[model samples]
Target: MKKILLFLLAISSPILSISQNSTTSQIDETFKAYTGWFVDAIFYEIPFSDTFQIPWVLIVLIGGAVFFTIYFKLINFTGFLTAIQVVRGKYEDIEKHGVDNLYGEDAIVEDILKANQEDELNVAGDQTPGGDNIETIRDESADGEVSHFQALTAALSATVGLGNIAGVAVALSIGGPGATFWMIVAGLLGMASKFAECTLGVKYRDVGADGTVYGGPMYYLTKGLKEKGAGGLGKVLAVLFAIFVVGGSFGGGNMFQANQAAAQFTKLFELTGENSGLYFGIVMAALVAVVIIGGIKRIASVTEKVVPFMAGIYVLAALVILFANFSLIDDAFGLIFEGAFSGLGIAGGLIGVMIQGIRRGAFSNEAGVGSAAIAHSAVRTKYPASEGIVALLEPFVDTVVICTMTALVIIITNFNGQFMEYGVEIKEGVELTAVAFDSVIPHFSIVLTIAVILFAFSTMISWSYYGMQGWKFLFGKGKITDLVYKVLFLLFVIVGASISLGAVIDFSDAMIFAMVVPNIIGVVMLSPIVKKELTKYMNAIKKKEIAIEEGAGDLNDQL
Candidate 1:
């Protein structure tokens, strides 16, 4: 704790001095210098042809998604229904059979040894001679800070932010309606990737003696790979993943969300002052601090409620617009498909459209970026596969459902004005979306603005937790350490709101995609383990070793 405090003090001095005196242009320029170098280094694009270039990180992301989808034998399909059941707690009875039952009388002694052993070595291996014995106790009582549903919501909160509201609009503005089709395809394929990584997240997680969960690609890459005799590679990848995700937490997850939210609010309210975003950010940071200080439990509590509410409102509004423009639905679909396949004079032709869609989809749902795995790692479950199953629904909700809705609304409302023009650029993603909503209903932009703020708020809080986890991995975990990170994270919220979006957006995107590099490597190397866990889980269900509550799978029962 003392070490953490001294470290915090050392860092805070410079931050405090800068915040008190730096001009906005100076701050922006400083941010640009740092963000530009990072993005330039990590996001170098690979040319596939004269006119097309794809980021190497994106290729890794897409490749991993496709590979996992096939390698897992389409678990995204076979396990989709089962995942729904898991989130509904249909299989929660397995929690009753914890590690205590594995050993009759020496459960207490074994648990003590388990704790110590896990601390010293990797706890991810369920069958390694001493490794399997160590996690028995942690796995006994559904070992996690949040329920399956809460975990899903927390992760969803992070992914379902501006990307859905603004990113789809941006894609459509540049690539036209064709981008929507590719985005949906990416989302579907990405489900398998989400399932694979999240499964590994739970499999390799370390449950602290007090029931705190520490896990993600960092845990899986290092520990799971060590078991496979690639300890050196695993450690390197883990560190790289940790570094990238921490940057993402600051950029994409924190700054981008705040910037967009503040942009929308300022436009909606006609706020002219430059510091409006700063004040808005301070309020958001305060609210976020209140929830995040309580840790994942509080974060889960807020997101479980906020996600459903905000999503419900946005979806409801979209539904209203769709219903109002019911006649144009078919026309929207026609444009989407036509623009997707037929060259619409888009920059790089059909390929450019496809690239825009997939890129934005990746940015929106974040299936393979591995950030969601951190949130899912905290789910309470005995079988790691259960959380992985539940995670499949994230992309479905964020992209397949919500993003599709947003796209349809944009396409339907703007069908007549050459809105589907391939070469034109829309500078404000939220504005395009807002215009679509306002077209259907007068004054709907106000509601949309509020929803944006809520979305940003939920995203900020969730990412704060995600960033802090990575921060803890880098700097040892303690109250002081945690406080330092949280302060720094909240500070970014204000900085994000106050700064120009150009450099920040580019950096945030590169950082987010950079996570894909190491994350995909770990997920690919560790996929066989995920497969084994899936098979065991299925067999347990079939043999009735895992109990199921009657009617628990019913959607009505969950509600």
Candidate 2:
């Protein structure tokens, strides 16, 4: 603990000094001076004409989603019911136990089990000359840390936060209501991307000697590519992914969350003085440290309960407003559709609207960005594709459902055009959303404030696990290394709240999206493997269904 404190003090000394000496705007400007180039490079837009251009990263994200949707034959649409079933444990029997006669022989099953056992022992550094005594194949399904629902909620907590609230508001404000149309389209396509990468996360994951699971893009990019004879390239991509994920965890996941949550809490209560943010930061950091230190299983446990409650409250509120203004629903949607195609009165016309929508959707769900894979990779299931299918629901819930609700409320409330002007950029999106909600439901901003804090807390914890995995990948899984990372992460929560570093946050957002580069390349190349896994899982389900029908027939005959 002394070492941990020393580390924290060393890091915090300079940060606190800056906060005490510099104004928020000055600190922001200082950060921009150093990080502006990297931010500009990451978000650099390529122009198609004099007026229209898009970020290359967005193209990669959307393009990969399109390709995965095509390659998987639209698994996003077809697997929706199956995903629900998987989460509900309807197929738990098949996932936990082998389908009878599915592989046809014990020898084949033994070979597969032995290969996995050897890999696990190798990672744990306990493999002997002849290996330990052989175990039954049933244990293969018991390797992961969290159940399907837990994994789903854990990943959802990260992606479904401020983006669903503030981000959707921003997209609509800039691109007009038409942006909503493209956002939904992009979200639907993003489901396929989620399915593909998460499948790889499980297929190539490592199970430690302590039954702890280690997986994500870092593992798959290395192990999956090595299987395809691209070992060197795979290692390179994995390292880069690890680096980017760590930076993202610090900036976007930890700091950005704390910063936004503090901002909202202070604004709502009308708290005054410079110490308000600092006090909030300290308390928030303490709460986050408690949850994150328990690791993924603990994080999953909390998120499973928190994600649903927060999401339900926010969605329920939206539903209340929507139901109250039932007559405006049709008009709002009409604006969305017409704006999507015609780009009427919106900047950059149809293409601009599409870009704004797709960009926000991609950013909101992070479907193709690969961070979700880290969370989903911890799911307890023998079949990798089952978890992948479960992961697809993230984009559906985040972008298609929650973000849509947010956009609708903004549009419906703007009937008088008093709240906001169409096509004008809005910087304070969360405030805008709060105003829109409060216009319909009095004191709704208070509920929104609680929701924002919950969103930020959950996001920070989940991303702590993500960044930890990457930290372990680069620095080894030593106790001291783990403590160091955690201490730094907690300190970052304080720093994020105590100061304003807009450029730092932007740079982190770039780092998060930058992950899409290596991740998309790896997943696309390994998509054939995802296909094989999907086929294997589907075949098992079919066989299980047939056996159930046969048993029912036998029972009928006996009767």
Candidate 2 yields a Cα-based lDDT of: 0.87
Clashing pairs in 2: none
Could you estimate the TM-score for every candidate? 0.87, 0.90
True-structure RMSD, every candidate: 7.2, 6.0
Candidate lDDT (C-alpha), each: 0.82, 0.87
- The prediction achieving the highest lDDT against the true structure is 2
TM-score of 2: 0.90
lDDT of 2 at 217: 98
lDDT of candidate 2 over 1-559, digit per residue (tens): 5644564565455455556556767777766666678789889999998767999999999999999999999999999999999898877655654565222333144444556567567646745533322221123445677889999999999999999999988998889999999999989999999999999999999877655778999999999999999999999999999989988998999999999999999998999889899999999999998888888888998999999999999999999999999999999999999999998787899999999999999999999888989988887778999999999999999999999999999999998887898899999899999999999999999999999999999999999999999988987777888888998899899988878767779888988988999999999999999999999999978876776675622111111
Per-residue error at 496 for model 1, in Å?
2.0
Regions of model 2 farther than 4 Å from truth: 1-21, 101-141, 552-559
